[model samples]
Target: MGILHTLSLLFITTPLLLLLLEENVSNVEARDHHHFGKKQKIKNSPKLSPAYSPAPAPSPRYPPSIPSDPSYGPTPTDYNSTRNCIFDVTDFGAIGDGATDDTAAFRSAWKAACQVENGVVFAPSDLVFMITSTIFSGPCQPGLVLQVDGVLMPPDGPDCWPKSDSNKQWLVFYRLDDMTLTGTGTIEGNGQKWWDLPCKPHRGPNGSTLPGPCDSPALIRFFMSSNLVVSGLRIQNSPQFHMKFDGCQGVLIDKLSISSPKLSPNTDGIHIENTKSVGIYNSVIGNGDDCISIGTGCSDVDIEAVTCGPSHGISIGSLGVQHSHACVSNITVRNAFIRDSDNGLRIKTWQGGTGSVTGISFENIQMENVRNCVIIDQYYCLTKACRNETSAVYLSDVTYRNIKGTYDVRSPPIHFACSDTVACTNITMSEVELLPYEGVLVDDPFCWNAYGLQETLTIPPIDCLQDGMPLSLAENSSYAC
Candidate 1:
């Protein structure tokens, strides 16, 4: 009876144990499958979602709206594309020995590179390339860069220049848009011979004068171009203007060191004419003539962070010469230092001009021993031959703010000799304290037909300023240019 009971118990227990073992195996397989799925996900899937990924950065404006605040520099889009499409001037039969005429080689390289988009015309570094008067004319492909790393030397003197080459300009970039000229290089204009011309101030060894033809060449000229950039260049000893921009729009010039001898004649550092929306930033200009000169048909120009010395200072030209009409407006020069300069801030216009100059601002300027700290001479004649005329370029809405300086005792700190018939209106000033550099005797500020309010009492008080516009300009709409 006992044996029979044992067999029965064993039968029941064996079936239950088999059932439990099957369930355990199935559970283990399911757990293993779940772990494998997680591993696959970890191995195959990307970490970040498309929604979380950041977007690419934006490109900079060629000529930024607030160009006085320049926050960007030139950068190539694709290095490989630029390298592959390089048109090397040396490869175009250029001899970088400083004596060979590299003009033809440069022309060839430019012609070839100008056709390719995102092209680079490279001037090899650590060499001196001599070129005669040459013009690099182009309506180049979208992104063109003239990367000049070598020293570019022009002809030794005026005697070396060919007669066919116009004495007005040497190296010219004409009709180019969306182009950049940049690199760590030097443009040496051997201008001693031109400066010694009879028409110039320095005539002969003994300071004697001689009669001769005198037409000096500008070092670089950008003519009839739009969307241009000139950066990181050192231009020295230009015969005339170092760099001139004529009929250009959306132009930017930055980080330039332009210089010439203190006695160099008519060597204006950077001159702009008929150009709009122009920007000049972070430059050092020390030349004989105006560091930065603005001619007629100029508007929306912004100049900042400039160091000008041994110069005639920055000027708004002898505009409206020969009884021509001149219209200039919206010019701002800010955060500049003028030291040992002939004039600090000046606006000189011709006597018999028709149009007007308005909406000008000079702010945060520091002058040290400047001869004429601030001046506006309507009768701006180089010689005594300029006869006075009734109609003149009307000057209005000119603001000089926070201009502090030391001036030479010879001349008054501020001189505003406006037009007699068309008096200057809204000529405002604030915090202008100009002390005499030599003595305590400070010259009084001079004013003629100038109207404005002083925000604060200046060091040498400006009691000469008269209130109210001239009757001719009050009734005329021409004053509102």
Candidate 2:
């Protein structure tokens, strides 16, 4: 009787145990599915730089973070889609013989691709296209990519350039937005002849300027554009500035190998005017003029990890030229290395201009045998014949920190040739040690009518800087501009 009872109990409990086990397995499967779905979502999310953060309004005392990686741009998509359409220059009758005038083919190709929603105007590899001074104007489709895998050479000399084309610019990209220009190709401006002209510096034994057609064209110019990216190209031997941006916004220049002869006159690596929200990163620029030149009406510009040498290191303006109202603000250049350059960092403005330059910073700079390691030449004049003017561009709130390097003994380690009436105000320098390159006699930091404070004692002490801004310029509205 006992054995029969035990058997009955076991049979009844067996079904209940099996039901619990099945429920447990279902719960485990559901949890695993939910976790996998989360993981997939994370994988599909857009990858962005964790380091980059833009500065707030007014001025930031610290360096603004930026995207660390250089690989941020458009990618491939479906070929059938209009936005993903690719138009090769060869399809438009380009010969790529290094002598044929492929300007027409390039223009035609650009027109066809520009109409597409997200088109690509491709210059295929293993080709050398000799294009003329052409203007590629566009109100093109969004996300257009100018993928250049071939060499694009300008006319061999100034004589070959068309008479109708403006000598001030070449390869103009006007009114284009959301465009990326990238490839392992070169844009070579055979500029030796242009530099040899009488008007250029190569003419005279004493490097004196002569009278002639002096306006040499920039290799590439972007006018009135937004959201532009130029990367992975070697732009070399420009007649004037290698790349010029005017009235543009949201420009990203990265990984460019821009080079010109050290004696190449007026061949500025990159020049910006009336542009804002610019980022120049991971580039090497060696030229005669400023590696990066900031002109009038520029603000919110950031430069990082650039190596500039055998050139003017970087400049903020020969602004307020010809008595124009020039206003530049919120400029920062950091993590840069300069070697054998003319000026490590410079802010130059002409006298007799009505405007201001404020909220500028240069940090983490390493200079090698640079001249004028830190300079603010408010009375900047190319020639010494510039007459002093009472009304000048107001310069204030400039900071120079972590600038350790060697400076040439020809000039003072620091030069602040401010205007008499409008003295530079609130100029701060900290952690700066600029020793003479080879001589034991270190030049004193020159401060001509400048005012500011040093956070600590610099290598060559700057005792000439006054404590604060002048009372007259404090309430002045010119600085507000």
Candidate 3:
């Protein structure tokens, strides 16, 4: 009985031990499956590389922030879509041959390229084409460009063409839109003979003021057009005005080199009349007459970044008598450097006229060796001399700021002569330092009966008024009182 009981106990113990071992094995298998599943998930999942690690993003390089100011929106730069057109002159048969008459070739190219849905008249390289008087009349689609790669040479010899008025002007662009002339090319007038022509040897029958006809051809002439652009060209030696824009709108002239000798008569760098929305910038002009002459009917014009030498600085009006319906307004000239010029800033109105000029501003202009830094002559067109007159028309709302320069003592620094009757009103000058020929700083002189200016104006020191002075008006009875 004892042997049977011992055997039973041993069997029971063995079974219990075996069952515990099985349970332990099952738990180990279950844990291994869970670990394997986790490993599989990690291997199959999308990998996260070092490049995509999240962090704060960097700021934009340009236009750091969206523009919130309405007035500070993106301006019209040269890179605008409206100004992107590449019309090559070479593709248009612009032969650079010095002897050949490439006028027909140019016209053909212009017609062909301009016929496209959106085309430009491109002058590819330097072309010495002899151009007779031709009219480039256009109702050009917007965004048309005229890219000049080379020079447009006028007829070299005076005797080569007919003496009639037909060949008087070499190139004429009339009634066009969105036109541009850009590149290092030149428009040479070849005016040696024309400029040498005697000024009609004698005067008119009445001995009246008959200006001599311009013997030389004009480099470029525009009439009754709009949205014109002339940039990056060396326009020189025109017997007449280098570029004349008459009765045009939205004209822009930038980065141009217009020059003639100091004695080159009637070589006005730019003459704008009867136009609106004109701008001239980044230019160097040296000529006989006014570097920039703003005639009657000019409004809302801006001229900046200009260097004028051996010429009149900035003139407004020579308006009078026969030309009576003259009006100019909202003109601004800034950041200019003038050397050895007759006058830094000038406004001349006819002794007898009926029109109004308003809202003119000249700022940050540096003048050296200027005869009259600032001059306003009511009696313009004076040949030998001028007398004080009461018949001058009205001029108003003119401002000159930050005009620092040296002047000749022989000529007064500031001469403001307004009409005694019509009166010039709202003329303001601030931070203007006129260093006399002797290097002495002097107060600006105000002419009497100039109208609407104060007497005994408080002057500021040179250093103190470096940038500019606030625009203000002082009340006084007499012009200098």
Candidate 4:
């Protein structure tokens, strides 16, 4: 370490070690003082000592924390201080003024941090660091940490974005294992200009199609990783999806406050695809697209106690697009609230795609002023003129228990537009109550080729739901996984 760095470590370590060892050190000192001989030696020791008492200037044995700046960071973890290898970004020439580019400093700090066991890269509180698109690649030692107690933001817009970097994602964590990114801070995307792009659906004249590529960046993503935890983060205003996890497993996301303008196009709060063993709990999200969207190849996902509003609600698949083989199963969304959203609980798939969506449950969900409270659209399409196709993904074993909500009168409360050939089967709804928000019922809750029995009488009754297996049930079993 350099002179400045040595001093920095010493300064930070003093308080942290004192915080950790104060009680033990006090007890030891009291035990020593209890002996009369040690007290007499201590009383005589000052005679042998110099005028300026050198009491071993606060032992730097433990790991260092953030410097004693006005913006001291929070305690990142409760682990033993001996296990932490701390690296502060400010030590590597980071100027956290929110305007200056801190990409190099952050990169350099991460390089050092990733080399050590139980590595911790600390972004201190009361600072805003703006960086460009960068991937923090890792095969680091287990228990790597990114303790962000401050703000992390991107450049102003696309014009300021680097041409060499990818436009699809920003701040990607690739090939990481056993990583925990927790913070009482903000990861603001500053995505106002990206939302105003000419290629955006709402941007062009008369909402017309602008002939251009409309690719904007998702704020943060974890790709090809596992055993990851992200919590206590206030992530907002993404150019596209706020947080996406792809090809990862053992993921847990909690206590996040994710938001964007309702009009911002394609700004899903959290999208997880090709991942499994995930738990998203106690998070609140309001954005343009689905609050949480589950994509293909995902299973064993439990989402609970999440609140969504002014956004499309939790969804499973806009999957199997372009004749792809998609598989999703064992997804549970329970104890959630949705309000002022487009589609509350949706499972949408495109035509001409073959796969299987099964073992899904939506329990104890409440909604207000939402359009299409519970839906399964097998023929999902953006364009008005989508030709009907016979081949489709088979959806089965879906249960909706204790779902009560109010829906916009424009769309039906419960709509199931299943494909004719591969109809949805074994669908059961128990204690579902969907009421019209405008106090006047639309009198049409449609269900097509959906085979399920209602456990209790539903409001505006689902009399359209069929009871037994369809004749095509034997043929629909071809698509499995």
Error of 4 at 321 (Å): 1.1
Error of 4 at 428 (Å): 0.5
Q: Which ten residues in a row have the lowest lDDT in candidate 1?
A: 24-33
Residue-by-residue lDDT tens digits, candidate 1, 231-278: 888999998888988889888788889999988888999988899989
Give candidate 3 regions above 4 Å deviation: 1-94, 164-168, 200-215, 382-390, 437-446, 452-481
Name model 2 segments beyond 4 Å from true. 1-69, 75-84, 205-208
Better of 3 and 4 by TM-score: 4
For candidate 3, write residues 1-481 as lDDT tens digits.
9645533332222434323212100000000000000111112222211111212122212121222121221122332343334445555565577777676767766655454545656665645656565666565555556556577777774677545434445566765776666666787777666555555222235533246543456667787787776777898887667787878887777778988877665677898888888777778899866799888888878777788888877788776533365678888887788888877798877666767788898987877778777877775653434444444456777887777766655556777766657666767776666565443444545463454332223222312111222233233222210
The lDDT of model 1 is 0.76
The collision pairs in model 1 are none
What overall lDDT goes with each candidate model?
0.76, 0.76, 0.61, 0.77
Q: What TM-score does each of the candidates earn?
A: 0.84, 0.83, 0.71, 0.83
Residue 90, candidate 4: alpha-carbon lDDT: 94
Per lDDT, the best of the predicted structures is 4
lDDT of 4 by residue, 1-481 (tens): 5545533332222444323321100000000001011111111111111112112122111111212121122346553264448888999999999999999999888878777777888888899999987777767777778988899999989999988656777787877888888778999998899988887765878876476577788899887888887888899999988998989987877678999999888899999889988877778899988899999999988777788979988889887777899999999887788989988999988889989999999988887889888888887875656777888999999999888867786777888888888889999998887766664565557888899989998865778789899875774444878
